[model samples]
Target: MPAPTRALLLIGPLLLFLALVYVLPFLGILRWSVTLPEPGLEQYRAALTDPLVRSVLWRTLRICAIVTVLSVVLAYIVALIWVRGSPVQRLVVELCILIPFWISVLTRAFGWLALLSNRGIVNGWLQATGLTSDPLTMVRNEFGVVVGMVHFLIPFAVFPLASAMRSVDERVLMAARGMGASRARVFWQVFLPMTRAGVIGAALVVFVFALGFFVTPAILGGGRSVMVAELIYLRIFQSPNWGLGAAISVLLMLAVGAMLAALLRQARPGGGS
Candidate 1:
């Protein structure tokens, strides 16, 4: 058999499985989005015009943006230590960063909820101290949502940066040192520029992941900071508006696809970051 034919045969089962599980369901959603609710694009039209939907969309984007920015910045610092630090330091950092991955998302979200809630430990501590008399609301708001998402996403942002950082030449740094360049100068100019692609790639990944976040926002936002994912759930489950929900789902999928495409382009050789 030809190489291409053999290759196709090898992965054909996986392709068929994905088509059955993913493509078919996606097609169903696309069909429902347009044909339901008395047909036409009524559902999509409503999605565009509805103020609540618009607000959720805006808030989702805003929160995702904030999470991506914060995650990348913090992850950069973490990745720097991860790449440049001593072996003991690297092992400790890896343990701290990787622990979250082993926990379920619900567990993590609820943990954040417990920690940040009005009567939670943080607020309790503040009240115990001379900080404030009343408990400050933390969870069930955008702040809590951002905090949760950034925590979840930082590990994601770190590895790509660490990969980029690891690929940096120690000889180049030594040469810079030999030239009497300051530590800050070498890092700011030589090191950072080399890792630009990784930073952009990590940011795109973090942003895209943040866009579809449901559980964390649902738990942390406490319905107060309803993002698109939660809004979709409400429309589908609570309102029983299948058409509207499907339309929103399609739109969200498209937005995610666009971001992923940009990330892919940036990752390709000779592709401009």
Candidate 2:
């Protein structure tokens, strides 16, 4: 066999697996969006024009944006510590971030619920310290949802950011400092510009991941702050509106694709997008 043909045969099984598991299911979703309920783009039209759908999309985008921003900020801090701190501090911080990876998403979501519920540990501490008499409403709302998402997404943001930061030539930083640049000036002008790609990459990743969240939002929001994923679940399972659910899923896929495409288009071989 020719070399190119042998290479293709070597990866054929993996390609077939992806086709069966991913490609077929995606095509099924696209088909349902147009074919069910008498077809002719009704579902797509409704998805675009319906007020309730619009509200849910807006809320989903808004919550995801918030989670992304918070995750980036916190991840930047964590990544900085991981890259710049003493060896012991770096080990501790990295372990703390990675520990959550071992825990299942469902477990983490439930853990947040246990900690953030009105009568949970946080409120108990506040009350005991005389901070407030009434229990604060934390869980089962937008605030709780954002907190859980940010916590879950910070690690995702951190890896890309840390990679970006590590690739920076420390000699450049030294040169800037040696040239009489102040600490703040060095960081704001020299260091940050070097890590620009990482920051944007981290933010993009967090935002995209947050956009499709289901379990955490469902558990934390408790139906009060429904996002796109939860709404899709309700539409498909509860209301039995598979067509509408598929439409929303397709729309979401498109939105994510657009972001990824824009990133690819703007990204350079050596610089930030």
Judge candidate 1 at residue 181 and give its lDDT: 99
**Model 2 RMSD, rounded to 1 decimal:** 1.4
Per-candidate TM-scores read: 0.96, 0.96
Q: Show model 1 residue runs off by greater than 4 Å.
A: none
Provide the lDDT at 227 for model 1. 95
Tens-digit per-residue lDDT, 107-171, candidate 2? 99999998989889999899999999999999889999999999899999999899889999999
How far in Å is the alpha carbon of 166 misplaced in model 2? Answer: 0.9
Off by over 4 Å in 2: 263-273
| Consecutive 10-residue window with the lowest summed lDDT within model 1 | 264-273
Residue-level lDDT of model 1, residues 167-200, one tens digit each, is 8889998898889999999989888998998899
